[model samples]
Target: MDIEFLKTSILEFVQNHKSYAPFVLGLMTFAESLAFVSLLLPTMTILIAVGFVLAAADIPFWQAWAGAVCGAFLGNWLSYEIGQRYKKTAYELWPLSRNPKLIARGEAFFQRFGPWAVFLGRFFGPIRAVIALIAGIFLMPQVLFQAANLASASVWAFIILAPGAGLAHYVLW
Candidate 1:
């Protein structure tokens, strides 16, 4: 029910099923990167915790990284597709409609960074959810969008997971 409990449960799941860490990380990153869904999940926190679990369990980081990369890429790609298909209607969507300021900020961020916004936005919590959608609304080129999405997703997953992994490795040793 609570975020802490949910986080603990997810971490416990990873610990108990160590072989599934990459799959779990993939799902979490997918949910975290997806537009509307990101608002609802504490996946970022879970991801950090999973990173720690991976190191403590001696799981290879690359496996988790690869799974995360694929999930994040697909999530953003789907959000972008939705914005492309729905266009202005995306603005009227529940969470986006409810938060005008968030939409405005995502628009401004997209305008400011252009295609790079997809890459840059992933690091920023508020805009990370919507930037890909904004990119779709504005009709950013497909190739460029994918380029940034893949690049950012790879690095973003690493940034989210690596610190905990490194710290855990240090402490465990």
Candidate 2:
């Protein structure tokens, strides 16, 4: 199937099953935030579309936004733990192993920015996926990582979903 067809189908699914939109969005954001999985799954675009769909379909925005935040936080937290446990071995994993530049960039970003990278990287596309891992590999303090993670996840969810939702709300309501 074409991308357009997939988009249409997903929009239809969200519209038809309003209650499931938040859950599906949570899964999408989870994949979008996960380390290796983020590279493979292009959920960002779909998530923006879902935001519009949620507003157009009159699904509660807070529910979907909360789900996205939780999913993103959990995904990043898992990546951080993996990096802590696996260390440099994480860079040897498939997909990550294949993309040396991504690892290098993530490392540089984390190194240059320190703990702030965890919060700032959430706003950047490629960095968002691996910053948490880099932080873990470098042994950043757990409390600091989580503080940045939680704050950034919440803001990121709002930034990603708000535009489409607000636009739809303005046009539809």
lDDT of 1 by residue, 57-80 (tens): 778899989889988999899999
Model 1 steric clash pairs: none
Q: Give the residue spans of candidate 1 off by over 4 A.
A: 1-16
What are the per-model numbers of colliding residue pairs? 0, 0
Q: In order, what lDDT does every prediction score?
A: 0.87, 0.88
Give TM-scores for every candidate, taking all chains together and pairing residue i with residue i.
0.90, 0.90
Q: Over all chains combined, what TM-score does candidate 2 have?
A: 0.90
